[model samples]
Target: MNLYLNLPSYGTIPVVNSKNQTPNSNVLTQITSTTSPFITKANGNITIRQSFWQPVPNVIRYTYKYLGNNQFQRLHTDPHSNLITNSNFPDTVFSNSVTYSGRLIGLILESPHEEEYHSILTSMIPIAPAQSQNATGGVIDREIEKLLEIFSLQQVAIPKTFQTDEIIHIVILNPIPYQTSLFHIHQRALKGTYCTLRNNVWKCIWNIPNVRSDFHSVLNRFSSNDILINCCTSQLQPILHTWLQNLPHTSAPHLLKGHHPSTLKMKGRWYQTIN
Candidate 1:
């Protein structure tokens, strides 16, 4: 998985230790003295160069935390290994680097197969408030505003203290496709799901067993004009429904329209209404 965080402004961000102290030039010495190998910094605007993969045990849990309001807030926890084959499998190697000019940002990598975690802490970085601007908008600003609008329409809560300048855009590539094993099972249990044309749009519905069962079939039928509004369960319904309603509409290729048999069962039956 790849994670990208875009910060609005650029300046020098410091790297500090768990005690919030700046390490001497001998960072390796500091790491050797620590009990656990947790990274101290992974600034989104800076490039970090550190190898996170090395010869180690297979089963390990990696946690990432960021300093917020003088406290470390947990951001992500990844417990994975080659032994597991699910979509959330951890990356084998990781590296992170950021440039001062806000370009050439590298990946933040962590692996249990390695001996230590290296990070740069941003808690000590002094960020200056952005200068006032006119009502005229920039492309990125407009996009952020649009996202805020969509979140509002969907009734998604916004942080009370959130400010436009403080907004950090994080885009995760290939997020775990499903929420849980049970949700995956529900998708697989669907049956009698078919797509049909209605008013120049494609509509689909899937019938699934009300009870849990291992029996399932692969679902490969779909079309570019097909919209999958109704074929999701309560777990996925809100997200899919809201995106379809608010985001730009597009027609997917027929080849990409097929459903994964494992995704068929959700909230009893699945409905897809295309527009």
Candidate 2:
């Protein structure tokens, strides 16, 4: 698993440790003596990297194809009976067919755990549906405005508190792109010549990855223009859903989309319709 963080503007830094927690007298002195290494320094520019697998809906899109019947099956005298015959059990031929698996896209972004309150409150209000809201007009404009306020504030605070110009940004990627990357599962099946020769029938399964390495390549970076708060598809809007749904009901939030991960589970927030 990989954790990628992008710092939008990270000029270098002369970093010092905040303070020591509980520690023995000798250990405390030793830790303080250790020098803090300085890596890359930016003026406010940082790249982003890191990855985490979220159990997202619609992880894949699937389609299947059918292959025509085998020649032996067509020629068999007893059509319903087994295809294997004394002379051709080993010689049976078959055509290969395939079906496409699914594809998933993920994003990585950063938020201040502290200032997350206002957006948390606002996001609960929910988005209007695509048709009703007609996001190109005023309604969409208002939502985006609110979101930018929250995220921009967080961006500004990061450098001031950390004494570094860099801050973390989101990095999204699919860790396992194909079924061949999955682990294997084995099971018993009715005995056939090939089955008799083998211990068991084995199948492969792919579980989501804990993290992917591609997230690291873009660490600590984002474009100032790209960091809009209330924008529809990019960073803030999706994250608001993720965070609000995770919060407690004392928050009393509403949602804009019935399809949001939280709303699907039946929660208290108002459902926003995205027009």
Candidate 1: stretches off by over 4 Å: 1-223, 226-233, 250-275
Total backbone collisions, model 1: 23
Go through the candidates in order and give each one's C-alpha lDDT: 0.21, 0.21
What TM-score does model 1 achieve against the real structure? Answer: 0.17
TM-scores for the candidates? 0.17, 0.18
Instruction: Name the 10 consecutive residues with the lowest summed lDDT in model 2.
Output: 199-208
Q: Indicate the worst ten consecutive residues by lDDT in candidate 1.
A: 196-205
Residue 255 of model 1, lDDT score: 16
